[model samples]
Target: MRYLAGNPFSAVTLPATLAPEWSLQIERALAPELLRALRESLDAHCARPGDEAAQCRIARAAIGLMVDSGLRRAEAAGARRSGVKRVDGIRGQSMWTLTLVGKRSKVRTVPASPATLDALRAH
Candidate 1:
């Protein structure tokens, strides 16, 4: 989702925008198996009590994000530990944000659900 700076004199060669950008669309519903796996993982994460809780939370959050969101496997794997953020806006309301280095090293923010953030905070 980047455009070349349009500097003709520059030597670096790159495309103005990634191809197939217009095809982006969010699906109406998640697949049944994907939903099941997500719920199971999140549940297991919550059930594991003790010092390993953070690991479970990270695992569950990662899985929930991929199935619940559009992140790819590699993208999820590359998600930095410092990138998970909660932003407060109007009336002390907060929204979870997932920041990661996307394709081509593009840093982007994704809106995460309250449930996802709650799971993340549990650990």
Candidate 2:
């Protein structure tokens, strides 16, 4: 059984009835190596010289955040659809960040990695 609270963002409590094998399958599917390989292949495909190089750079960064950071599909979509923002930190340091309305309409922040920052700069 699963029980939900009045607040959507509140966690749902569910009986621990999932089969161990099924959980293992999910773990394998989300393995870091597989995600890393996917990110590298997409980056390579986008890095090839082309008229769409500019667009490719942005796509590559998004893919990195999605695969490396484990962003939810909705979070990724919202970031691209609504756009990201740059903020200046202490002493004029700048960083790229995106606020995404994720599960249950909860707002969360995802930081850009150095590689992602470089890709954003290139684009």
Best by lDDT: 1
- lDDT string for model 1 (1-123, tens) is 346757656887776553222222467557788788868866876687776766777777776777555777798888775877879978999877787766766666776787776666664
lDDT of 2 by residue, 18-65 (tens): 221111113324667876786677677677888676677777766766
Candidate 1 TM-score, true structure as reference: 0.56
Residue 13 C-alpha lDDT in model 1? 75
Q: Any residue pairs clashing in model 1, and if so which?
A: none
Q: Which stretches of candidate 1 lie over 4 Å from their true place?
A: 1-25, 32-37, 41-58, 90-92
Q: What are the RMSDs of all candidates, in order?
A: 8.4, 11.1
TM-score of 2: 0.51
TM-scores of the models, in the given order? 0.56, 0.51
44 in model 1: Cα distance from truth in Å?
4.8
What ranges in model 2 sit over 4 Å off? 1-29, 51-55, 80-97
